[model samples]
Target: MDDTSFLGSYTVGTDAGMCCLWQPEHFAHVTSYDVWEDALGNDPAIERSIEAGAFVPLYLHSDGVYQVTLRTGARTPREKRYTTASSEPYLLVSKGAVALSGIEAVGADLDAAETIALAPGRYAVEVHLIDWQAEPGSTDADGNAVDGALPDFVVEISPEPDPAPPYRRTVETFDLPEE
Candidate 1:
């Protein structure tokens, strides 16, 4: 079967619902964009390909974020589609600390607290999707969404860790009046 491990997929009702919930491994250097304005409309050159069922993955190098947008006419039903993959972003660990770990939807807004802290070190990280495979009928015989394999990411920490952020203490002294 084709590999869709790096792609997120789901179907929404006519009322515009979410397809799936996916939490990116790291939150640093993450930013959001408007699908209609930024991805599809920004570049008029790629308009033809996009309309031809091309779901391109947009990479934001500076922000360390990746986005894939799918747009369908109101008449055309939304369906799952797989596109090309690129260099995925990773969590950067410099200081010996990570801040957060929690479930988040793919298109949900992210904040500073979305990060997880780890021991101070240098690392290269990879992200993966979890058990979110939809059954043929969208439910198991018992009438529950099928749970796929456990999703997890990997990280390689370096022995020679970078120095932590610099620190400077301030000192204040007052001269007493001499009698």
Candidate 2:
């Protein structure tokens, strides 16, 4: 696997007041698929990746494409306020193309993320995270100033079911002299 293929770690944690390192999976090459075109939306690069089996769509939502999952770290059901945040903000799986797949501000401390069904295979993946900044007069649903950013990263995927290679088939026929 190449060092340039990864963006960073998917999750970050604080231990005894120390920041952990960001270590994500890596892959030498990727095999992309366009399995979410209809459900999501369209992108020429995504289509090309699928055709070439170079990368797959993990999450996408922009310019009419909406495909992602909501994640809220809140545990209590009656918590008045629960803030949601995420690392792994944006992704660029193609050779040199970048894509945004992070969630926007909703309410009730809800966060957004992407989900994909894999066929069990090793994949070169791009991981996206949020890099938030404070806006002077911005306000969220809960009356808090909105601050967020989209940062892209990369990782390697290993599906359990292991995806099948691109479809290919052929036929052969033989003929005998009217025996």
* Candidate 2 Cα lDDT to native: 0.25
The total of clashing pairs for model 2 equals: 23
Question: Lowest summed-lDDT stretch of 10 residues in model 1?
Answer: 166-175
TM-scores of all candidate predictions against the true structure:
0.25, 0.21
Per-residue error (Å), model 2, residue 168: 15
Report the lDDT tens digits of candidate 1 across residue range 1-179. 22322222222111111111122333222345343234323335223322221211121112222222211111111121211121232323335443222212222243422333344554333222222233245457776555542112112222332553221111101122379
TM-score of 1: 0.25
Query: Which tens-of-lDDT digit does each residue in 65-167 have in candidate 2?
Result: 2212112121112111221232221122233322223212111121221222233333333222221223233456776434432222122332222344332
Error of 2 at 120 (Å): 15
